[model samples]
Target: MGKVKKTRKNTYNYNVDRKKLRRRAKKKSAPRIQCDEIRNAWNRSKSLAGNMAEMGLVADPNKSLPIRERTVIGEPSKVRKPYVLEGLKAAASLPSKQTMGISSDMIMYVRHMVENYGEDYKAMARDEQNYYQDTPKQIMRKVNLYKHHHTKEYQTLLASRTKQ
Candidate 1:
């Protein structure tokens, strides 16, 4: 038998770009979360809640985490454990893509879950195209940039797009 050759995919070169993402991140005005922020804040919650079965913390979304009946805080006894902990748990359980927000499949899944599950439990995911797009004017500008670099290759690509 002859050996088969495998076709390789075109891998994007991130190395050809900047050395660090932080440099560009620091220049922004207000502190904004990055587009690629993945939070793992619920790992501890899951572990702790799992361990504390005696506390009788059920997985019901309507109820909150079961703290020991009485625990003492230093001064302010009126305060509660940060509400973000629950949100983190819920977000961790969500089946949405990390990069492009919510996909169509995820939306459909949400729709189904909302119908079958509880409407209060259902949440919408961010829905947008993952990749950047160039407007017609921007496309022309990019063509000009590429034409400036490699005139022959640029012309060939542009010509192919118009030939249909």
Candidate 2:
């Protein structure tokens, strides 16, 4: 004869109230004081005639205070001075692109490389304009530098190329 298998009895209560359990699990915090209550307390303290008030340290809250007129200080004098031509005029006249270390020739070279090789740095190195005899790595660096400095122009170039 085969041995009989024993059945396990269920211990968990299926009728337990989940809402009551959740309520019991929630953390209780102290009620916060309102800002108006704090302000009223401050006003009450200030209104009292204390030793600090007698010493003229704390101003009387009941007394009307003067409205301080805003005055401008350390402002430049309006007197006109003689016009001086500093070397800054030359720098100011130059184009924003010229301010970057990458020259126009280098930009043109990079543009040409991209237009022809389409990011093939080794092929770009073999191109006729690789007059500097820059290796593939050096050419890639120059291209990346150009792209970084002139992002908008590079984006436009790509967009135009895609349209073609």
Per-candidate local distance difference test: 0.40, 0.63
Supply the TM-score for candidate 1. 0.18
N/CA/C clash count, model 1: 0
User: What is the Cα-based TM-score of model 2?
Assistant: 0.38
Give me the candidate number with maximum TM-score.
2
Write candidate 1's Cα lDDT for 23-137 as tens digits: 6666653344242222222333444444223223333433443364543222233323334445547767888675433345534443333233232221212223212343434
- Worst window of 10 by summed lDDT in candidate 2: 78-87
